[model samples]
Target: MSVLSALGSINWIAVLLAVVAYSALGGVWFAVLFAKPYAASLGRESLPQPAQPALFFGGPAVATLFVVITTATLMAALNIDAAADAVVFALVVGVGYLAANTVIIAINPNMPRPLFYGLISGAYHLVGIVVTALIVVAF
Candidate 1:
């Protein structure tokens, strides 16, 4: 099916749930679970209060929505109706695209501990994708 048709056929409720779950995971992962480690990865004594907190939080929310939407669209296009198939496909995309790109993006001049940061962030995406896949396929 074409991308447009796939988009139309997508379960929007599933997409919304996935986005909320994925974004909430990020909030907990960074803000609660690994706050210290994440700060260390950035070479900060502690998590700094961003001047533009809206961008800090809102950017990821928007990105999470896009990620969930894209994953749902792909699942629809590929006819991944089964939860198992959705999981497998999610793993593939999570590791191949999200994790790899996270690592690459982390390895930048400003990042003090790029590898560590990559591991934390990439793992988040990996799990987020799986959670999203399950929701998308469930509906």
Candidate 2:
């Protein structure tokens, strides 16, 4: 099936749920678990509050939903139904594309600790994709 077909068949509700799940995960994943470390990576004792709080939170939420919408649509297009298939797909995109580029991009910026940024970013991308994929399959 093509992307157009997938869009017709995809369960938007499920995709929305998956987006929320990962978004919540990110909120805790960095904002709480890696709070200090994340701040440290940016060479700051604390992350500064965004001038517009809505943009700060809403921006990522919107991006997350968009990611789910498109990827889940592709999954539907590809007829990704099996657990193994979804896992493999997620791993390929998450690690091969997202994670690898994250390392390179973070390093190129001369980040204080390139590995730290990569690790944090890579973990989120990998886990977020997996969780979203699983939910896409489940619901």
Best by TM-score: 1
Among all candidates shown, the one with the greatest lDDT: 1
What does candidate 1 score on TM?
0.94
lDDT (0-100) at residue 29 of candidate 1? 94
* Per-candidate local distance difference test: 0.92, 0.85
The superposed Cα distance between candidate 2 and the true structure at residue 16, in angstroms, equals 0.8
Using Cα atoms with residue i matched to residue i, what is each candidate's TM-score against the true structure? 0.94, 0.88
Candidate 2 deviant stretches above 4 angstroms:
46-52
lDDT per residue for candidate 2 within 51-101, as digits (tens), equals 757887899899888888987998998899987899988999899877888
**What's the CA error at residue 51 for candidate 1, in Å?**
5.2
lDDT of 1 at 90: 92
